[model samples]
Target chain A: MVAKRTVSEVGEFGLIGRFTEGRVQPVSTLLGPGDDAAVVAAPDGRVAASTDVLVAGVHFRLDWSTPEQVGRKAAAVNLADVAAMGAVPTALLVGLGCPPDLPADVAEQVAAGLWAEASRVGAGVVGGDVVSAPALVVSVTVLGDLRGRAPVTRAGASAGEVLALAGRTGWAAAGLALLAAGRETPPGPVAAQRVPEPPYRAGPAAAEAGATAMIDISDGLLADLGHIAEASGVGLDVRSSALPVPPELAEAAAELGADAVSWLLTGGEDHALAATFPADAALPDGWRVIGRATPGAAVTVDGEPYAGPAGWTHFT
Target chain B: MVAKRTVSEVGEFGLIGRFTEGRVQPVSTLLGPGDDAAVVAAPDGRVAASTDVLVAGVHFRLDWSTPEQVGRKAAAVNLADVAAMGAVPTALLVGLGCPPDLPADVAEQVAAGLWAEASRVGAGVVGGDVVSAPALVVSVTVLGDLRGRAPVTRAGASAGEVLALAGRTGWAAAGLALLAAGRETPPGPVAAQRVPEPPYRAGPAAAEAGATAMIDISDGLLADLGHIAEASGVGLDVRSSALPVPPELAEAAAELGADAVSWLLTGGEDHALAATFPADAALPDGWRVIGRATPGAAVTVDGEPYAGPAGWTHFT
Candidate 1:
């Protein structure tokens, strides 16, 4: 039988080595892991950056979500933010907090998630610090490159531009609903909720196609789009009929007695790409035109007040 | 009379706006807050990055230290890591998790600390995310520029190289001991534990001097030096009498029945720069020669085995 090793036995430095060993870094990275900080090539002379923190019992649960899921989601959410800037992710630094009793494999799983998502975005988990916490908390910071393209901002949308989405919405919310139902899962909506596969490439694609304004659908579709509207000083109009409710969402909503339309309009964490393009520009594949940028400050849907849920507000 | 609003009153967006208002961004940053991610100039074709997370009870106590202290400590630690990579500080991304009932002033103080420390390193807090948690946790990610200098790593130390240190050691541990002893008002050593002043410029100076290997003594002088020895496959010999023990540490150690030399050797949080230099190299002004690198895996003092504390180990 193998003797069990505790973190205290090896110490933080030894454990850090165990957690970071075999991790590959990009060629442009001058340093990785074992140094004070990791250096990565940023030849573009600019970097796009963002940070997100996930707390246990709020953002995730140890019982419901595996450590790998928690780690992936923690990293994926931050990467999505960077991608929303119309940049390619280059590197990430992670701050992890967990109880002392937490298994070493759990930490490794979290790292696995971070590694997988980072690889998906053509980036690497370059550097990080791990410490003890009262509860599991994962904090991730992403550094990205614009690759010489203009960054799409929320304040650039002009009147008459087409408001569109390039990724699926309401899928994660539907997954949540399924999870709430306590149904043993398979390849279903709940699974998607566990791991949100963001429309990572669409951000750069939109930048390439001259997208004027952009934001990620983390805080519901209407709410985040509203941010662009307010920042750009423009009005937004959504055709309610244009809402893309995944079939799984309709099924879950029907079973849960929740309105699927509300889920499509206000549910968040789908990581769908929302942006405004010049009316004359060609639309990219998988993108659906859902609305138009107008000359007011309000967000309207289908020329009427179709209120189910507005959006998510922090500290509410 | 206008009533001060709680975070719940205006909600998350309003709080974010308040935090971002009156803040000026650097010219290198193309985009700031209120966006999906912040865009900053990363000239030199590369970016240096590091991250750290500080928990309220474990890392900092609200009763003992102000929120600003927490913020400064949080950002300072990450920035110190970046500085360790022989890079110029550029920008920071922050992730904060707190309870809904946390006062807005507390958040402001934290932000003020973050901004103050960031400015000290010639960088700006470019973007952040605020979320709900059961406890207060601050995570900061810093990005830096190498300015075309090759990063010095721990693996490059060679036999016959002189080991030198560029900052004080054991100050924080002395402060911590004072704090634990109910000596809340320790004259100098106490504050040192609250906020360590790392020798920020020494890293770049070492890089410019073509130092072969480097590390920041965050986890005690001897413990962190052990990292260099293990990484470079060499033995190190430390001199007890050469240690730069602050007068306050010596005074406090006497009262606590501890030896200042042991603390100087094994205490941590000094964030001093330690490096291995060629035998014939000219040493910088601030650096002091404390040891020599030799072929082997052992670390000794004065050509003999020195029985002393081995420094801190996490979860131990």
Candidate 2:
């Protein structure tokens, strides 16, 4: 049998060809890979953009998560950021740093996963660069179209607005807890942790329904809402009883002797959308009312300050 | 005296605030940093985008270049890619991975350099993410507007066209050679290696002048021209006598026992724009004709194959 090839053996240009040769591009991709730069359509006269970087040991472990999973997470985080702005993602540009000794197949699998997630929302993998580094570092930049709608920012919330959430929270945190405890019997939480299913369409739907403010829950609910509260100059109060904690999380917490509610409050990386709407506005499908924007500057759980760890802070 | 503070001491949000608090954004930045994502104007209904990843020890050595210079190089490279596509850069999004122990001042200096370079072109530093990593990695994504001109792609070159160049070459490579030889007497070459001054306006000028094909000479004159030859299915021949070998390059070459002509033909990273124009077309200002496109495939110097190293490949 032939020896397995490393990225060094395939070379940079060859590896780029492998990643882009047969991929299909969406209509928004005016020009795809294999050029000095890629051209993407932004028909609304504006483009929404965001960037995120992930490192190997700090953000993920190769032994615990597959390269494909890591790639999906990278794309998901940036895509969710664009969606949080009430935009439809149009294209993704990746800047990947890899060790020379990494298997070619592993790098290709990572590209495959990026394409998979981008294609899920009709976005194209437009362009990328790969270079040798000390460890794996994935940097993704996503571009989106506002479609003639005003972007929903975190500073639009007002006091007396109803707080709402769309999509699951705390499941990824529970998965991390299970993994840290070295018990992975329940597959749902672990799967959620690997590849988040962000509510991509809910952001625009909420925008059309008159969402005043919005954010994606990459940090814990309290910490992320704290951002909204700080930016909008309004306080927020969450009713703990209204949070939907999946049964799997409760079961895993029971086995681990951990509080599921704490995970729901402080765990991050679930990529759920949270927003505030006028008290009289209709809540969109898949969204449920959970709290209200208050008159002071603080994030409270049942009108009391939360005492658990706040949220993730990189480099800390 | 106050002790030095590391990035970990500043925290992610604190560091982001430090980088963004005092910066001024251009008109293209509809919404600047502080929200989940930034919105930028795309007046022509399409945006040109490119990404490049620069890693410590691979693309740069901290001991050889200042953090500020490294940051400039990172932004310059991606900006050059957008310029090569005949577009005007509008915004930049950075993805930075830094070691936890890195001094906060150094990171601030890096941000300062990025802003300095972007502001030169009227582009805004729209958004970014910073995370903990084993080594420093700067991933920059630059977005540009086409201004309604069709992009000058590599595949448009035709036989019987005049080949031209619009910026400096071989200077950065000579500086690298000087640094490798442990001599710093000539400051010009060393400075060129530290930061490149790409002829950014020349790209759009060439497009407006009806350039048939164009590429930035990031991988040396011969190697980058080879890309155009392959894409456009033509042969390229450079006249050795017409190449401009600057006096400083000749002096550096004589002292280092290297051939100055070879450096002019094969040195990379000057970010000069090389393009093909119709034989009867009036070439744009700052551009000089140096070669011709032929009726077959191959890149030649003095009508023969180049025998030295062609260019760079990251993994190899």
Lowest summed-lDDT stretch of 10 residues in model 1 chain B?
Answer: B2-11
* Per-residue accuracy of model 1 over A7-64 as CA lDDT, tens digit each: 4455566667766788887765667787778888776788889998888887777777
What C-alpha RMSD separates each model from the true structure? 2.3, 1.0
Interface RMSD of each: 1.9, 0.7
Correct interface contacts retained, every candidate: 0.86, 0.91
Question: Where does candidate 1 stray beyond 4 Å?
Answer: A1-11, A184-187, B1-10
Candidate 2, superposed: residue stretches over 4 Å from native: none
lDDT scores in order: 0.82, 0.91
Question: How far out, in Å, is residue B142 in model 1?
Answer: 1.2
Query: Over the full model, what C-alpha lDDT does candidate 1 score relative to the true structure?
Result: 0.82
Indicate the worst ten consecutive residues by lDDT in candidate 2 chain B: B183-192
Residues B53-103, candidate 2: write the lDDT tens digits.
989898888888898998888888888888898999999999989898999
Candidate 1 per-residue lDDT over residues B206-247, each given as its tens digit:
878878988888888888888898889998898877876667
Q: On a 0 to 100 scale, what is the lDDT of residue B273 in model 1?
A: 85
Question: Which candidate wins on lDDT?
Answer: 2
